[model samples]
Target: MERRRSFPDVLAGVVFILIGGAFVAGSLGYELGTPLRMGPGAFPLLVGAVVAALGLAIVVKGLVAGEVIAFGPIPWRAVGVIVLALVFFGFTVRGLGFVPASLVTALLTTVASKRVRPLMAVAVAAGLTLAATLIFVVGLQLRLPLWGPWLGF
Candidate 1:
């Protein structure tokens, strides 16, 4: 006898498949380039293929094993915290810069976890924000606003 598939697993598989297909289709318009040099489409194509494969595997496992996926109660507080943080990031990043925005986002996310201390969360958020700023701005040399014109960073 086959095991029942979980509803969550099935739903996840379907969602992944849909997302993967969208990615694949979206990447098709991008230039893939010659074998010597990878173009814009290369990474997206690879990601899309991997996502589709994972989705297919999940779906196949669900169907063949007959596993029954279940979900517990929704964590609304956590979701709200994350959404709020992201919204703040979207609004503040241009004005405040990456480090500050990241710090805020991290703090909010940590608090959302509901297990971390406030001080520790603040410290972690600061450290993560600094590190990320260094990596993305300094190391990668990607153009990002460090601060508004007033600060002149």
Candidate 2:
């Protein structure tokens, strides 16, 4: 018996490795400061090494897994909807404010899935919006307004 390749996993691993390599390469120009005072390259260098290691591990797993895997059909419609929702959120985040932007985007993305209920989407959107606002704005003090200038926040 012959083993077929797991194309998706293998491709993903390669992509990760490429991205990690790019990150490391870009960080090489900057000075790497000590842990007490991190330089421009320090964080990126650390993250890049970790990501590269993870990609290597993924590649190893994919190779060892016999390269034989069954893949489900890609959901193009769902993918399109999610991408559009992300674009919408990006455009509206400043104008509509974080909560509203998040809610609208969540609903827009949720509509892509046939199994999701309207009420459930609303509930999830609300919960996610609140959590995002609290975590990023209130707790982290990210300076992004819960409501933006358009809303007089």
Candidate 3:
């Protein structure tokens, strides 16, 4: 026997549809004029349409399939770590510089991942931070400081 749609699933579908509709309506008011070509509204309008379609599909699928979607338990620890890391980034990025901020953020996020060991996670985070710095800062010629002025970089 097929399972029936639960209240939560129905609510989620309705919420998504409402949000998508709002985005579409908001995008319509954005001026669609530019000298070169398509204006700022074009991309948002496309995104809104896609969101609306996906929301509609979700609603239709839930109704037809009649299956209750079960979400797993929330990972509170991971959420906390991510939020803290973001705060740390915001506070430290300008003063401590990109490399350190990136490392700290990456390490926190990696540690939050369920599968990672502390040592391996640290190593991966360091590697990723270095790679990101090289790509986004050096290669892209972005003006981010490699190290703080106190460290004299």
Candidate 4:
């Protein structure tokens, strides 16, 4: 029996390696000071090395004993919706404030799946919004207003 290779793992590992390599190379341009007084390049250099090593390990694992996963067709609609949702959140967060912006963003993301019902999406969105508000505003004490100037608050 022929050994099977995991295509997704190999591809992901390659991507990680490329990204890590880029960071390592970019860091070389800056001054990497000693461990005691690290320069800007030091952190990136260390991080990049770790990333590249991890990527290499992933690639090796993929080639040696990889799990077989069915690569399905790309859901372009879901992808587009998610991208739009992220953009919407970034664009409206300041204007609409945290709660409303998060709610809308979460709703858009939840509805990205075609099988999700409207009521379910709304509920999920509300939950996500509340969680985000509590985590970011209440817990973290982020200075963003719950209601922005647009709401006359």
Per-candidate TM-scores read 0.53, 0.52, 0.56, 0.62
What tens-digit string does per-residue lDDT give for candidate 1 at 39-136? 89988988998998899888878776746545888889899999999999998888888777888899899988768988899899988988988899
* Location of the lowest summed lDDT over 10 successive residues in candidate 2: 1-10
Q: What is the lDDT of candidate 2?
A: 0.84
lDDT by residue (40-151, candidate 2, tens digit) is 9999998998898888887877766645667779998899999999999999898878888988898888889979998998888888888888888889988666777777
Model 4: per-residue Cα lDDT over 5-109, one tens digit each: 888888888998999999999999999999899999999999999999999998988898767888889999899989999999899889989888898889999
- Number of backbone collisions per candidate: 12, 1, 0, 0
Model 1: what TM-score? Answer: 0.53
Q: Which model scores highest in TM-score?
A: 4
Instruction: List model 3 lDDT by residue over 36-95, tens digit each.
Output: 787878777788888878878877777766465577698998999999999999988888
Model 4, residue 39: C-alpha shift (Å): 4.1
Compute the lDDT for candidate 3: 0.83
Model 4 Cα shift for residue 44 (angstroms):
3.5
Could you give me the TM-score of model 4 versus the true structure?
0.62
